[model samples]
Target: MPIEVLPVRPSFVARVIGADLTALSPAATAAIGTAIDTYSVLIVPDQHLDDDHLLTLGKTFGDVEPPRNHRVVQRLKHAELADISNLDANNRLRAADDHRRLDSLGNRLWHSDASFREVPGALSMLFAHVVPPAGGETEFADLRAAYDALDAPMQARIEGLAVEHSIFHSRGQLGHTDYTDAERAALPPVLHPLVRVHPVSKRKTLYMGSHASHIVGWPMPDGRLLLRDLMEHATQREFVYRHAWRVGDLVIWDNRCTMHRGRSYDDATHPRDLRRVTTKDLSMLQPA
Candidate 1:
């Protein structure tokens, strides 16, 4: 059967059927690419993919981002595959006060993946290996739709503004200050337009996320207030989609036009294992 794209929500997410990502033809790969541009989020069910298969599929889209400097090295075999689980490198559940677990708590805040990087991220592929019985859902907000709903005055006010982003700033929000000097140096603050124009769809999108620190030229307090206000407005119920994950499911989302956050679960009791592979956004070169 041919691949099919069916909308899960009226605004942005869709469920793709009839395609196996591990054994995709060139045409099918192109079709998935087109669907990503049009739908922004695609949920492919029953995909039994391993690390190698995940990395292979990620390369088909663009250059996959490799593991960066961190206090604990990623336990995944490949540097390109990110470990998004609540377990330690030994495959055991982390302690309540583990530094890595504390740092990862920032994922619960709504943010775009790799938006703190200078090049940012284009697409993200997150596959579930183990899912919790309840909770642990991911919620995505459609930035394009949120932008469209903004009043003309608010849109014009942020039209040419630039926002500085840093991964450290985001983790700091959760009182996570255990980063090594090397880790801090590896990821410095980067600037990007507060309002970005989506390359393929040509739609305007609100770009600020939890990683965003402040408007480049605006005072810190005022910029922070404006960012908080925008986040509140952009993540309204009408623009959000909450995804309940299942094992063997692979979810692909365009980081350029959406922000997502992981919901809380009984981390101490349940194991929710998911791995992510992100592709760099070459189009975001020289963020202005």
Candidate 2:
């Protein structure tokens, strides 16, 4: 049974209608894989998924990425479920000045999940348990579309370029340097091509985000400037989608061709709870 999908945009983004993620038919599952390659982002509403269910669904995509030590308390049971929320270990809203809250503020920066790693993330499945009354929407930019919009000469210039990405650099941008020495050592910088061809779709997509520190082998200042310029161009309104989250909604996005960021909400006054699981990109094991 093919899943019914409504396109949110001509180039990317769609809403999967009336499909129970927990009990997918083989045909439906294949349709979803096809949808991901075509749409890059899918919003599935009215899902009832627990941590166990989320973990199971994530495995259908690929190897689930393990949780990284951000020096924050582990609120969830599964090591694969990332605690994407404003609550503490006790399930209460965190203090406005809590270190965990401060560190999470980096999610507001446009970034592809796990781009700083040696093996970058492929798909990010985020499930909304509770959403704030206002704000807190997630925005995604279509890197394939952004890349296509580039002029021919600009495309040729960056065709063979690679970028050095670092988790420290992105967190440093927000003055949130509360990392433990062990955490710092675990998350050293890595290199990835500036433009990578999608394994399934074969479209050239820009592999950049807040984690992208600078272009490899270029002078620091020049590399930073180029990265900044590319970021500005890639995130133009024409290539972006904003998702206003609702409770029970699960959004899945392809990190291979998209960058996303969370919008601002009143963290002190309202509670916004979401959990995420990402899959590792196997294409990363091969040459990019």
Candidate 3:
């Protein structure tokens, strides 16, 4: 079947149809890649994918990032898939006071995946195997449009600035302080340009998010204010797409040019099991 790409938003998201994600042909792969480059988010609905199937689809884009050596013990057994759920290892709901649940609360804040890593993430694929009756929607902001919408003066002011991002800073905002000294040492903050140009599409995008602590070479107070301002501006209603998920839905997003957050859901009473596989940026694999 011929692949079809239908826009979900005027700016940057689309729904792709008529391709088997598990057994994509070269032509289908090219079409999907082009769709992704044109629309940063692609939603493929009513699809069933196991871990192996998810991994196969993820590798079509780039190197699938290994599951993080998380400081917090992981409940999921699969090393390739990140568990984005409220259940424990035995699939029981965690207590309201569970530290893992607290850690996941940070997901409510807008963030780009792996922004704090030296080699930032390129793309992320999330599959919804179970979804709640209400809420649990994921919201994505189009940073490309956000960058273009800026006034001339504002654009010039931020064009060359960089920001320092850290996992500690983002998680700290939600009162998650379980990281040990060694974990902190291993995952120190990294710097990335506030305005990034997509290597393929050649479009520029704003990269600030919850993980972005402060601007480089600026006073802490001023830097934080600027970061907050940019985040607010980028996530305005006009530049956003809110996706209401359903079971058997697969959503892929470019982390390099977007910021996303999970909406609140009734985790204690409802099950919302999702699996995620991410690919590393190609540039990260290149020799410096």
Give the Cα lDDT of each candidate. 0.91, 0.92, 0.88
Judged by lDDT, which candidate is best? Answer: 2
- Supply candidate 3's per-residue lDDT for 126: 97
lDDT of 1 at 249: 91
Model 1 TM-score, 2 decimals: 0.97
Per residue, candidate 3 scores C-alpha lDDT tens digits across 198-248 of 878988889878999999999999999989888889999999999999898
lDDT of 1: 0.91
What is candidate 1's lDDT per residue for 1-288, written digit by digit as tens?
689999887659999999898899988898899999988999999998999999999998999987452667667878888888898888888899988889889999999999999888899999999999999999999999999999999999999999999999999998888887888888989989999999889899999788999999889999999999999998999999999999999999999999999999999999989999999989887444
Candidate 1, residue 8: how far the Cα is off, in Å: 1.5
Cα RMSDs, all models: 1.3, 1.0, 1.7
With candidate 2 superimposed using the best TM-score fit, by how many Å does residue 136's alpha carbon deviate from the native? 0.3
Q: Quote the RMSD, in angstroms, for model 3.
A: 1.7
Error of 3 at 121 (Å): 0.9
lDDT of 2 by residue, 1-288 (tens): 457988999869999987888887878888888898999999999999999889989998899988564666778879899999999999999998898888889899999999989988999999999999999999999999999999999999899998999888898999988888888899899999999999999999999999999998899999999889999999999999999999999999999999999999999999999999999998999864
Span of ten consecutive residues with least summed lDDT in model 3:
68-77
TM agreement with the true structure for every prediction: 0.97, 0.98, 0.96
